[model samples]
Target: MVSAPLPASALPQDSKDRLRLWIRLLRASRTIEAELRERLKQQFDTTLPRFDVLAALYRSPEGMLMSDLSRYLLVSNGNVTGIIDRLVSEGLVLRARRNGDRRTSIVRLTRAGSEQFRAMAAAHEGWIDELLGGVSGNDTQRLTAMLKSFRSNWEGRE
Candidate 1:
């Protein structure tokens, strides 16, 4: 399907505003995520995926089933498996067979892993606060609320 050459701002005014907002949101999110990824690597010699796995385990105290972990992380089972294997080998996580289910395993952070994640969490919080320091608390709250509303609207569209 051939298409005509479009003008720079092909969208109408309101649409252009919404499109600009979306682009700004994407850019801001990417910038912050990139900085956090770099900081995680530099400060803990860890990747975001590893940190995220630990974070999930840390939250689940008793632990989560392997399948559940993958669902919660919104990643494929293979992705979670590799991270879990490494964490298990590093003594940062423990895995055990669930009763009557040899194929399924439960996983959780070990004490060391918990401590390490806590340290990283603290630093991560500070880094975010520093990055967004210029924004007022009220503005932050308003943006968060708006995003939440937007998400709910789309998510509930189903």
Candidate 2:
């Protein structure tokens, strides 16, 4: 497949705006995620996906099913299953066949898992603080509000 080079002036205005927004988002996300992962490894010997799963489980009032975890993490069922397998093997998570539902399993964070998650959550917040400390508090608030507004508008679309 052959693609023609796009001159900046020739590109649609909306296309250029979308491209710039995506590029900024991707770069910022990557840098922040990379730093978070590095700190997680150094401090907790965990990865972002594992932390994400545990964080989701931490938020569930009655725990979460494997399918629910997959959806919450925006990952494939196979991926969630593999993550569950490892966490269960490490005794950080418990998987039980739901009452009256042998085919469905609900997973919960164990006491140890909760403690680990709390520590990780603290460290994660510290990392975020480190990243944004240079920015003024008011600016941070405005930026967060703007992002929320943008997200609301974006979700309202389509």
Candidate 3:
């Protein structure tokens, strides 16, 4: 029941163009995400959430608090809990009480998890490169800068 998106080319150089740009950006993001999700599942038998958790842990080798991990992934603690539980059961992640503080937990990737994530990360990088291959490096750099500025503009809003 969704209406077809208007063609960006048909939009004038005005507010309509802005709307079209936003729609195009969203569509591109979702398309890439869908493909990435499928590739992660079919190739590694894993989901994007699990891969994201591992990637976060892999970056912070010293480990992170469970709440911090959830925030880093932009997901609720409840959502992260189930993913962590499964990773722990699979021996891909380890959790420990922090310095006799039962209220706090530290989570990190296991050695196996690091190795596995590294492999997946490499492929992921290549996949992104392939998908974005159409864009020239200069254009990509400009687009990235524009997006970063756009994010900062909004994030700074009260």
Global local distance difference test of model 1: 0.95
Of candidates 2 and 1, the better by lDDT? 1
lDDT of 3 by residue, 75-149 (tens): 999999999999999999999999999998999999999999999999999999999999999999999999999
Give lDDT tens digits, candidate 2, residues 1-158: 99988999999999999899989989998998999999999999999999999999999848998888898787999998898899999998999998969888899999999999999999899899999789899998998998999898888466
Best prediction by lDDT: 3
Q: Count of backbone clashes for each model?
A: 0, 0, 0
TM-score of 1: 0.91
**Model 1 weakest 10-residue run by lDDT:** 4-13
Worst lDDT 10-window in candidate 2: 149-158
TM-score of each prediction: 0.91, 0.86, 0.89
The residue pairs found clashing in candidate 3 are none
C-alpha lDDT of residue 36 in model 1: 97
